[model samples]
Target: MESSMKKPAPDQHDFHFWTDEKFRIADTDLNGHINNNAVGQFYEAGRGEIISSVLGPPAKRSIGAALARVQIDYLAEAHYPGMARIGSRIARLGTSSITIAQAIFVEGRCIGMAESVIVFLDKATRKPTPMPDAVRDGFTLLG
Candidate 1:
């Protein structure tokens, strides 16, 4: 369990991520609002985008030895074909993984929050890998 994040605040350094997304017509379930699964998908995409920007795409056949425990909180409702903007930040860093916190907003309205615990993994053994230098630098708060 080795962590790469030195600082707790990702915003202190103006480190922020914004991605434009629109709800698909198929996202709506019988309830009308976005489906339960959709929320998690949106959050994952946002978080993945942040990491991918630095590491390119994760090695599919060889992902870093890491497992993610994801938790999502829904605050408001979203409609299909609606626009959503996701913001990502780092909340905490443990010995082996980092906890990233993300929020989904539509036209400035807070709809939900998603948190994920991502571990750095070794491609060879699928075991937790020591934080790499490049990843460590990428996760560094902007400041």
Candidate 2:
């Protein structure tokens, strides 16, 4: 029997944060396709940009955010020597946590999608801390 799962499609307008990245030769595996780890890095790049835009640069902040969980679905294989557009948006927000939805597209094809949960925490205590009003408001604007 064939699986009933459906693959995700590329929809850039559905996300608020957008960026484009080029795949390097090193990003490919021996099979000449982009490696899963490279795809993960693309997702990380999107998450980092969103977090920085909302919460300020990590170097200047005493508090920091950490990834609580990340789930990625690989929809299609991607080759190197190409560019990809990555989109990220806030899926949910809590007092000290936020869930981000991300998609990677190459030539208008959805190659991967990911959902990540990040928790804001105090650097010193390493425990969850309420997000600042400014940061929360910034995230709200993106949604």
Candidate 3:
């Protein structure tokens, strides 16, 4: 699929939360490039980090969060034996969900960009739940 990120390239300064990921040899495909699945994992790690930092750990929260949807655009191929810098930021917030904007950079170049939606759920019923005031306020600071 084509992504609008093709032109003007993504800038790291647009993101607030950053996660450092190592591109392992095992993450490479037969073509000697890092696979798409591996790139997704990097995005997951970045999302987890930003969530934990903003809302605290999962074990202590009354509400849980789950990834509802994700759209990633492969802008360039990434190779192994390199470091991936994943950048994440809250793009939009809803009553029960948050939309995250992300970009993956390898060797200082943007390789991919993604947007993910995460829904808040009640821990007991597992149904969609409204975000707490404190939680909303916390994430607002980051955005």
lDDT agreement with native, every candidate: 0.71, 0.89, 0.92
TM-score of 3: 0.93
What digit string (tens of lDDT, one per residue) describes model 3 on residues 1-143? Answer: 86665455579998888999998988999999999999999999999999999778889877899999999989999897999999999999999999999999987899999999999999999999999999999888777
TM-score of 2: 0.92
TM-scores of all candidate predictions against the true structure: 0.81, 0.92, 0.93
For candidate 2, the C-alpha RMSD (Å) to the true structure equals 2.9
- Tens-digit lDDT track for model 1 on 27-105? 8889898898878778878777876765677755234634478877677799887887888876776655778777788
Candidate 3 stretches greater than 4 Å from native: 1-8
Candidate that would win on TM-score? 3
Backbone clash tally (model 2) = 0
lDDT of 1 at 82: 89
Superpose all Cα atoms of candidate 1 onto the true structure and report the RMSD in Å to 1 decimal: 6.2
Q: Using lDDT as the measure, name the better of candidate 2 and candidate 3.
A: 3
Q: In candidate 1, what residue range of length 10 has the lowest lDDT sum?
A: 6-15
lDDT sort, best first: 3, 2, 1
